[model samples]
Target: MEQHYITVPISRDNPQDVFTVNTKYRVIRRVGSGAYGTVCSAFDQQHQRFCAIKKMHRVFEKELVTKRCIREMKLLQLFSNHPRIIQLFDMDIVYGLDEVYLIFGCMDASLHDVIHSQQPLDTVHAQWFIYQTLSGLKYIHSANVVHRDLKPANILVNKDCDIRICDFGMARAFSQTNSMPYLTEYVTTRWYRAPEIMINSHNYSKAIDIWSAGCVFGEILGRKVLFQGRDHVDQLYKILGVLGLPNDISFWDPSEAVSAHIKNLCTTDGLPPPTEPVDFNAFFPSATPEAIELLKRLLHLDPAKRITAEEALKHPFVQPFSDSVEESLVPPYVDPQQYYIFEDVHNNSALKSMAIQEIEFFKHRMSQQELSESLLTNNTDGTITTAKRSHTAAVATTMRHFDSSSSWQL
Candidate 1:
């Protein structure tokens, strides 16, 4: 096979952080790093635009990490057609280094950055942002995929106010069966986690994502984190502090053990449970009544009673921006059980084998996309190629091309 990518050397401040990437991308700067990968902004010479390149180093070091890497790649491919979700452009693997690289559409900044910056967000901005977030969530939930991590940092935005939900490494696809597999409580960030998840509910539903979206909505409105907790115990208290204890514990349908656990935390220490929920109008005095009402529905303590993404889109706060036609449309759905194939593979060698296959699959898809774009650009007859143009339109939608006049700074 002909090599589609080449290793390029770039100067770095930290020697240990140096990386090898495709020559098609010129590293602009290191953007962020985490336990599993390092992300950098790069100029895609081939596409004539900027893109975010994430390099996952030493992927084979742990089985769990390798699984996550593969899962993210697969999920990105499945949702490539959705405009609101981040799109994966290309991917490659280092031959001998056991490293992986994923290229995705670039954005200006994360919602976290926007909230913390001096930028002022008006009510319209809040409504649009939350609407886009829920829009993406509705499509994702339609496919039965749960984006377990939905914090502000995972949501990327541009100056145009376009929202693209990213970071699906922690996401999971649920089987269609009535009985759900045991999920880990360590899924979402502590502050954004649903009350059921914090209490260690064995079988949580897609409602957990709604809770996280609610937290993000509140943060955007308040210009700060809605629930800031020192630890898990403190996190629960923080949620209860604002929402107050439910009038009836059974409303939440907690397991017997979980019920006792909650009771113990409330009574064992000198801390007393909140007697009344905080007044939304006073807490977020700037928020309109419609925004307050939507926030309450999203942040409901009981997952069962919480508003779903589909219903939230129709809420009064965002109704003006919500397109009834778009809301009714459904995207392509992928069976959740398709990802279960990886669960049986235990050894690092087997995991690596699967990873290589996925990389090749994405490479083929990228090449086909490039070929279609090449044909569209090279065609001379504008009137005669209308059919061809329509045929290739879907695959030809690449990252937004930037010209010399475009501003790259956030």
Candidate 2:
């Protein structure tokens, strides 16, 4: 194997002014910044490719941020090979250093950029993008990972119109069966959030992501956000105004969790009342029948009635691109719970120590070793060694080969 390094030119007196990596990647310039940290476009000398590196800021300042960052790394690695999911090339974690930088494949632009640019996407392009989203969501759902945040901003696209889902900081794996854990706390963006999440319903399912995806699809078609709300309350009202009110509330919650909000907003007296449902055709008058049907199913008020990724992929609008929706090379199941990096939201020294340990574990799993010539020079059997692209691939292969049990150890 060849060892690659990125070199930096610096004056003798100003050695610290130049940017450099372990000799594999060189930072070109800052691209953007997010809640996690600053992102930069970099050159990968090893692979002769350009990549993006995110330097995580204030990772240990809050336990929730730390946990979400760690989970993002884990899930990114877990779904690295998926065609529509972002590829994490490398993770840089220096010993005793408080900061961590994540290296990823560079993308042409994000769906947010496209939507906000006021670009008009034809029906073919809109259907293609939506199909790709559903394809990726199917794979993520197959792994039991719920991308709680599935908005245009989190979805990246290339010049070829290829899509990749990014920002898995809020993603989590849950039971596929009906016994899902109660995740009552807020999770997604205001406009793209599902109705179940809007009302603080505890029975959130994978379908919440479908709702967000539907919103993204609608934005692509309408060239604007389908439902623009100022707040969570307004957001729910916008959804109800479009989809109208559902007759049955039992699926949402029998205890009046969702209905309570409607009662407070729509009624003069604090009591439930029958509201006429709006016709889907009126809202999406410009959309084709197939597109309208798919959007309606995705934006259903009831999560249970919402279309699953698999079902959405089969819809007439997206089915034409079935050939493009290839099966992803998903890795074995590694319980994210086992790698709980944070205890609670606090800035305790112990939490900082734990955060460092989690990062160290990632570095250890990602680093490869040199092979000795003496061990293989006399071997007659033909064999070759390949460098693993990212830590998730390496860790997943290791876990699958050594043990498939829920408890994973390096």
Candidate 3:
């Protein structure tokens, strides 16, 4: 893949130089879509890299998408050269619409798919993955940015057991203290939301992000979401019930820097708050002490008391591998998380764009190792992979019907 840095804009009158491969990169297919744009994975012939391109559509105002485009560009720029975080290489205006192509490293699969496949991942793997995520969060938080959304869908894994955090469309940044509807308040999916936010505690903090991160950590170990709720109230109840209810102190205080959101949100009907630390190991019996300790620190009800990202990276679970973990070092590498979208193919455009790259990559692999899309066959060593394609990384997988034993098959 090409490692290039460029900040250029395509002209409305430029005649669409890169879109045409026979446009340039030979359209592969569509990937997926969000509110305003489509993400397509296209192969850049000239660049010789697998690129995910965001082509702005006319759905929202041109000005709005332009602003979002710039916002994403700026956010990516803030984390420039950050390896764990996705890298933004270029943003431009193409064919009368604003377009941005961000570059991220490749990965074999995602932590989510692996877990959701119903295979049990060991605590060591779970700990290591969470630690990498926290390290990325530490970097982003140090820069005063908040990842609004944290979910299994956003976590990816590389061949070397490295984890990467991805997606910043809903991310926010604060140079000074502030309140919520954070430039991106929609911090995460329903299942992983924090308590304060769920209870409508308008005055939120980076701790919310940390809490969601903890939720991701839980998902890794339990092979499922620990708190799976359908709505904000249900979500809060799930967290509070599992972690137990909070007292007045756990709620917001007007004495602090927040607006009157707390008082306004909470009712006169007060509830008892527990003083004891919740025993998480009881719930996650298979988890290591290290993982439980980190989760407690992350899921603290009080935003002020929750563990900071930098502090989290210092924890033993993550610290041991901090120096060598690929996800901890940003920039010039792919964020495994960015590509873990399970072939959703951002709005179909990215899939279309990436087809040529996939084909080329497939051929390249075939030539080198005679690779095929077949599953395990009979082998002399009793392990099909041991005889061929031994280089393939395996995770605890339950994806295949019969291989209930493989952790990564999912």
* Model 2 / residue 253 / CA error / Å: 2.1
- Candidate 2 TM-score, true structure as reference: 0.78
lDDT for each residue of candidate 1 in 80-155, tens digit (9 for 90 to 100)? 5676789788898988898899998988888888887767677877887898899889988888888999999999
Instruction: Give the per-residue lDDT of model 3 (tens digit) for 93-184.
Output: 33333244444444444667677765545655675678778877877766556777877777666555556666676676554455323332
> Whole-model lDDT for model 2 versus the true structure?
0.71
Candidate 1 regions with alpha-carbon error over 4 angstroms: 4-11, 182-185, 253-257, 264-269, 324-333, 376-410
lDDT of 2 by residue, 1-410 (tens): 34454535333576553334567777776666776676778888867999987777666666666767777777887787788899988776544445667888898778887766634566677777898888899888887778899999888877656779999887877754745452533588888988777665666879889999999988887778988988877777677766667666666667666566565565335433336656656766677889988988888777877899988888998765675425453456555444343423356577666656665666666553223443555435666564433223432342212122212110
Looking at model 3, which ten-residue stretch has the lowest summed lDDT?
387-396
RMSD of each: 5.4, 10.0, 12.1
* Top model number, lDDT: 1
Q: TM-score for all predictions? A: 0.88, 0.78, 0.65
lDDT of each: 0.80, 0.71, 0.57
Candidate 1 clashes between residue pairs 3 or more apart in a chain or in different chains: none
Ranking of all predicted structures according to TM-score, beginning with the best and ending with the worst = 1, 2, 3
- Stretches off by above 4 angstroms in model 2 are 1-20, 94-97, 177-185, 256-261, 267-279, 329-410
